[model samples]
Target: MATYEEVKDIPNQLDKYLVDVRNKSELKETGTLPASINIPLPDLEKALNLPDEEFKASYGRVKPSTEAVVIFSCKAGGRAARAANLAKTMGFANAKAYPGSWTEWAQKEGK
Candidate 1:
């Protein structure tokens, strides 16, 4: 899980990598972080089958060797953590979960 400090630093680090796991409804309701790609968990199975060339074409050449960190985020911490763990198991060694997800972001946005 990412700390508060890490969340604060995301904007700067985002240029390198960031992935948003919120569903379509959630994304439509709330704006996402800059450069964050929407990859809903339900769609993961389909994503796995995407041709490597297609994946690279769409997501900018992500190989097992890609150095960018993959941060998964959802409404709350739970789903994001699950996605992060899955990503790690699937060879994304730098996957991380943002505990302060949309719920926290929404609360802060109100203030």
Candidate 2:
């Protein structure tokens, strides 16, 4: 799993989707890190398969290539790591799981 220190310096590029896999209620209870897109782990495959225009229409932006940086996060490291592994199995070469997930982010952001 990627550490907060590792992912913190990653570029906030438009094509990269910082995914928050925690459910909607969790999202509502605690706001996500800046730039993250809420596509719970269960929906990840479908979301990634969308065509450029459709994706932009649905997700509000286009995603990078399967080989590009795609960051995943959850309440802690476990879920995000599993999500990242799933991404890789789905052909996303650069998918990374943030070990310092919501808890770490919340602590750092003072949420």
Candidate 3:
């Protein structure tokens, strides 16, 4: 699992992928974590499976390798955890969930 602090600094980490599992509507309503990409839970598996070039064309970001550090976040964490587990099952050993997610992030950051 990932804590709010860890998620906050993900941008500085450079290689880490902070994936927000919330739907695009939710992100428009509540905003999203700094530097996190929107990859809704329902589409996450297929997104992760996309080839590198295709993934980049679709999401405008490179596809994370199986060993990459991929962290997931959602409204209150449920979907984030589910996404992380799914990534792990698909061979992403470093997948993790940000339990505090958007709720805690908004509270702490006063967004």
Candidate 4:
């Protein structure tokens, strides 16, 4: 699991990808974390499987290699945990879940 401090420090870390697994509606209702990419949990598998070019076109970012460190976060961390497990099954060796997630972030950041 990842901590809020680690998530906050992500912008300075080039090897980490902070992924928000919340759906679009939720994100619109309650903004996402800084420097995080939205990849709704439902679409995560397909998104990860997309070709490099297609992935970039769809997500506006490079596809994460299997060796890349991916940190998944969601509303209350449930979906993030699931997403991390899913990524691990798909061969992402360093996949992790942010247990405190957005709720903690918002509370801590006064958002």
**Judged by lDDT, which candidate is best?**
4
The parts of candidate 1 lying over 4 Å away from their true place are 45-52, 59-67
The residue-by-residue lDDT of candidate 4 on 16-108, one tens digit each, is 899999999999999989889999999999999999999989987889999998999999999999999999999999999999999999999
Identify the superior model by TM-score, candidate 1 or candidate 4: 4
Q: Rate the local accuracy (lDDT) of all candidates.
A: 0.70, 0.81, 0.92, 0.95
Clash pairs detected, candidate 3: none
**What lDDT does candidate 3 reach at residue 11?**
82
For model 2, give the 10-residue run with minimal summed lDDT.
Answer: 6-15
The local distance difference test score of model 4 is: 0.95
What TM-scores do the predictions have? 0.75, 0.87, 0.97, 0.97
lDDT order of candidates, top first: 4, 3, 2, 1
In model 1, which residue pairs have backbone atoms overlapping below 3 Å? Answer: none
Q: Pick the winner on lDDT between candidates 3 and 4.
A: 4
Q: Write the per-residue lDDT of candidate 3 for residues 7-47, one digit (tens) a residue.
A: 98998987999999998999889987888889899999899
Model 4 ranges off by over 4 Å:
none
